[model samples]
Target: MDALPIAPYIPQHVKELLNVSIKLIRFQYIDYSGILRCRVLTASFCLEQDQNVKFVGTGPAALYASYVEGTDTTPVAAACRLVPDWSSFRVCTYAARHASVMCRIYETLNSFGFRRCPRTCLYKVLEIAEKELRCTFLGGYEIEVVFMDVTKSPPTPFKNVVEWSLMEGLRGRPIEILEQIAESLEAANISVQQLHTEGSQGLFEITTGPLRLMEATDALVYTHETIKTICDKHGLVATCFPKPSAAKGLVGQHLHLSISSLENDPIEARTVDAYIAGILSHLRAICAFTLPSHDSYTRVQDRRGTNGTWVTWGTEFRDVPLRKIESTHWEIRCMDGTANVYLAVAALIAAGIDGIRSGRKLSWGDSQKSPSLMTDSAREELGIKTRLPLSLKEALGAIKTDLTLSSTMSQSLVEKYIKIKTEEAESLEKMSPEERTELGIKYF
Candidate 1:
């Protein structure tokens, strides 16, 4: 028998969703504060060919809502639009009758992306890297989360302690929860590289396979949502907060990145060297994006198994903030779950591209040991002259002072981000330690 043909006029993405029996399409975007927001539409409404059907109006303040209280800081008069990037459509296997598509914010329905939109900013930065530097990047992230049973008085974690990456850590219900999360993500077309327990109490890490920069970030956001949703079903709260448990351990969102020459050509030795050098040079400033919250600084001082405190790079060294995995591949350990993934990636890539343009030299020697362990003279010999910012305030100062880094992004965007984060840090500083942790748990 002959096969029936697909509809020629139907949008491919819509058709794919309809094929999977999706009844609702959710237009989603991550804001500057790293919170995911969405608007929903019936699949039939989205299937319309009209361009107006693809755009959803939102308030300008939606882009800068404060992290804690959800306060809107922007003027109320201006409005924005969410235009779905159909290419990023993915079925939400955990949510029946629903699908999700990442959206780009625009000033008007007919306009290009809004300058303040983190995702749009990232797209522009990636375009620069591909067009000007003749390079592209593949990136992956390690999502570390702690699950707490909110039913308890103090919200206790799983009573059992799970050793890092050990088989014995796989237990009954907790393991089942993790298994379901992995399977659901895989069903959503996100590649799950590995799932294992971390040393922290009730903490688990999911390693996702790398994709091109944009897709990888999209996957990271979706992964966070999936983890939260599946855990809620099991009567647990999953938080990616950097310091969810102050006494137990910290959580991180370690990033792995690799660079490639355009068209699969061999990347030059100098290009690779400069890229790493660029990142190191701007490490402190980049922290403003990668580690944005006051809680994030808690991880910096605890060097036992946390991100190293000093600014340096080393080969195959977990203690260093930056680890050179190979010539073109590297691991950044300082990043945490508090960051907007889009802005973080954009800053990192822009720094690397800046390094290439300036022909920045790799002046620092590879450290055989953590900078803290080495003698001052030994560190000086290796040109390890700087420390990662010690606090959220200091990190914001670093961003403010680094004109070279700020020049890469839109001036208004940088100012607004800095203002928002600065206010958040100030507000967080007023709360008691317990209050801060509780708020982190509630919203993260």
Candidate 2:
């Protein structure tokens, strides 16, 4: 159906987010890939507390078009939660875009079939984080994305060059849009760090200082929208698609996460080892969430023996599924700009936290080369178990059956995720491999 854009009273949502009285309400929805897309309206207590308010659709928010035909008739859908930390002023925000086009979006917190979408799935993960981890996860994230031409008329290499070379120095659709985003982020309580071009052509990365988990994710949502607006103004497209099915270049959102102690401690102790174990143990399965696309497998392949293996690990090799950095946390390399930011971050944190709570031993996988760079046997023995699923079906099977993971992660979320991913695979299966790769949306 028809989605009517609505932007009224959204400022009230923003006001509540800021005051100690209002809780943080997040408005969230699902796009075509069944990934959660969001717009963080605001965190607040009372509308009376503020006179000025701001609303925005973050980078993750730009994933869905308000006017897609046939499916997802509901557009105005929203889900809101109070920040676990703030019980007094209680900051609550809707993950909504405030445009009239979002009218059909469901708003009830307990609505059934609502959880069918990944947004709700994310909510479920947060719930688990609360009960099991027994710690409040707060911190900002660094997200990377690539912008380029994929409309098929022709590839514009210079546009990509301009995006990388001139983003911050000059002012254009890219910079102007990001400036609005930076402003919106500051208003939302998320801090912005510096960002720049990444390895792939047309690629860009935004690094925000460590944020409370809520604000960090919110920053992602805002950045997504700002980038989209800038692209549209310049008659360009900025996509978060994992492998846009085109040679436009690889696009994936990398997550740099650190968990501070809710218990007032600064370090997580062996929490690092435990987190590593859970991630490595469940990595093959985690691939379903991290890389989430058929085109992804192809991206992992080497052009001339340059690309190798099913999984790799390293402090250096970028191809590895798990990359430990000099910093306090690990950088998951397999994820691409393709998947949902909320979903990827939630899945990873859930897995990592699961390891911590269960006292799971994170076998320090090989540090020599990338997990993708090493032999399968060598990787497997060092707790690099379970080959990364080449197919979405395989990944679903892995996650669905893992007794340890299932106990913590929602089974409903699993079923819903599988349903969405299965449809994606089936749709792609209709086309030949060449056709699939050439669909040219942006990833493989």
The most accurate candidate by TM-score is 1
TM-score of each: 0.93, 0.68
Single out the weakest 10-residue window by summed lDDT for candidate 1. Answer: 1-10
Q: lDDT tens string, model 1, 308-345?
A: 88888888877778888899889989899989889998
The alpha-carbon lDDT assigned to residue 153 of candidate 2 equals 54
Candidate 2: regions farther than 4 A off: 1-28, 31-124, 130-132, 149-189, 245-248, 302-312, 371-385, 432-444
CA displacement after TM-score superposition, residue 319 of candidate 2 (Å): 2.6
- Model 2: worst 10 consecutive residues (lDDT sum): 81-90
Model 2: per-residue lDDT, tens digit, 89-152? Answer: 1121222323211211322333432333344445566666666675555555556554556564
Query: Alpha-carbon error at 354 in model 1, in Å?
Result: 0.4
For candidate 2, the TM-score is 0.68
**lDDT scores in order:** 0.82, 0.52
